[model samples]
Target: MDVSNAFLHGHLEGQVFYQQPTSFIDSAHPDHLTFRSTLSDASLFVYRQGSTTAYLLLYVDDIILTASTADLLRQLTDRLRAEFALKDLGPLHYFLGIEVVRRADGFFLHQRNYAHELLDRAGMLNCKPAATPVDTEAKLSTTDGTLASDASSYRSIVGALQYLTLTRPELQYHSAGVPPYARLT
Candidate 1:
């Protein structure tokens, strides 16, 4: 599920000065001042029941809630709705770029779509599949090759690959040693 305008719900701590949006100006509180609140801790809230537990993971505006039973899940959802405006997206299939597939054994998480998009962006969509993502024995040195013309793209792809490591541990072993600015040799 997703929260509508999640950032706006964040409570400012201390003194915050800002001109209210013209459209949202309140005539009653023209000189409105936001005060510190305990809302920031809402991102992660967990509930436990004996051997069972319910987990709520919040990333900015997106929220993923899971529980061992349907009744518990429903109770949590209702409580959340009461506190904030939430749009229930129903079952979890796609989140961030990870695709979740439920199986008899358990839930499987993959990032095929995200990987495809990354490959396309790198103009490697049609590239041949490699037996391994990187060469283990290849030695990369700073003085080995000329610098890439667009270092930003290289850094961007590396950053994306770092995120891809969430579902691809193999990539982590290969990429963990590569610095963001390391040029191809």
Candidate 2:
């Protein structure tokens, strides 16, 4: 489910000051102290009842909630709706570039589309798939290859691959070896 204006719903703790925009200057408070809250994995909260557990994963404005029982899920959704304006997008299908498919046994999460997009962004959509993401025998040296002209694009692809490893653990080892940006000494 998606929360409308999720960031605005969060409670601001510390004091934050901001100058008024030239167009929308508030006469009451020309210079205002605004409070904003940022969400992270550390903000996740779990509720357990006996063997049943409900998990709440929060990533900024997006939230994924799962429970062992329908009743628990309903209760949690109601509580969240009461606290914040929520738009129920029905069963989870796509989230954070990960496509979720429901199976009789459980759910299957895949990033096939995301991977394709990444490849396209890297101009490697037509590239052949290798048995391994990285060659085990090949030695990568900083001085071996010339620097890429588009360093930002290289970094972007590497960053995306790092995120893709979240669902594909096998790629973790390969992705970990890649530096965000290439450097030559």
lDDT of 2 by residue, 1-185 (tens): 88898677568789988764434645786643222222444546566766777888777778888889999889888978987899998899999888889999998877778887887898877776554555779989988989988999889888897887765765544345443121100
* lDDT score of residue 103 within candidate 1: 92
Tens digits of per-residue lDDT for model 1 on 80-140? Answer: 7987899999889999888899899999877777888898988887776554556789999
lDDT of each: 0.72, 0.72
Number of colliding residue pairs in each model? 0, 0
Query: Which pairs clash in the backbone of model 2?
Result: none
What is the TM-score (0 to 1) of candidate 1? Answer: 0.63
Off by over 4 Å in 2: 7-44, 49-52, 132-145, 172-185
Clashing pairs in 1: none
TM-score of 2: 0.63
lDDT of 2: 0.72
